[model samples]
Target: MDWTTVEKNWAAYTPRVLTRWPGLDEDEVLATDGDLDRFAEYLAIATSQSVQGARDEARGWAEGEEPADAKMDPTRDNERIFDSAKNIPVGEDVYSADADFGDDRIPEPPMDRKAG
Candidate 1:
């Protein structure tokens, strides 16, 4: 499949995925050129060339022939964008601490070992 089609599909599916797990973001879920290229390469290797035209061209390279397509630099949006988690300070009030000692204390030790 073309990268645009794959990305469009991902965009459509992003909401459902987010509904299932709110932690994930749309950008991260969308496919990147790198991801598409890898997938296409794998498809070319694993499946018959006739099955998918996209694989037909890459099948040779997948089978060890040199790649025909020149590798391109990643786009600005190629990588997923994410906001780092905010650092929240924890206060002592959140956790209470208490220590108690018995009325009886340890006796003094002998000053000299030889005395024993």
Candidate 2:
């Protein structure tokens, strides 16, 4: 991820930048307009880091690996309401005929079950 890539995907990257540097004001960061040098300057001022240090940090971040989902266009997609749902293990039997779980409960063991 080069500066050009970051600049092209500024909207998607803004949230990440704000999250990583909470001391930075949104408006000030937005004002940089995806200029890496300008952003580094702002970061240095906000975090009290040396200008060179801030520049290196910002450069590293620009060149770092971002999660695939972070690059998604939020406006065109619906929120995954069930994203937090538990995942069942592969090849695991979900329903046991021997279990006596009632209709109101799932067949899975209790989440807080202790080891024998």
The prediction achieving the highest TM-score against the true structure is 2
**Number of the top candidate by lDDT?**
2
Cα TM-score of candidate 1: 0.21
Candidate 1, poorest ten consecutive residues by summed lDDT: 64-73
lDDT of each: 0.39, 0.73
How much RMSD separates candidate 2 from the native structure? 8.6
lDDT of 1 at 115: 29
lDDT of 2 by residue, 5-115 (tens): 787667667888988887789999888988888888889999999989998998888777764555565642443333422453455444644244335445556789953
Model 1 CA deviation exceeding 4 Å by range: 1-8, 31-116
Local accuracy of candidate 1 as per-residue lDDT tens digits, 55-85 = 4443332333212222221332333222111
The true-versus-predicted C-alpha distance at residue 92 of model 1, in Å, is: 78
lDDT of 1: 0.39
| Deviation (Å) of 74 in candidate 1 | 29
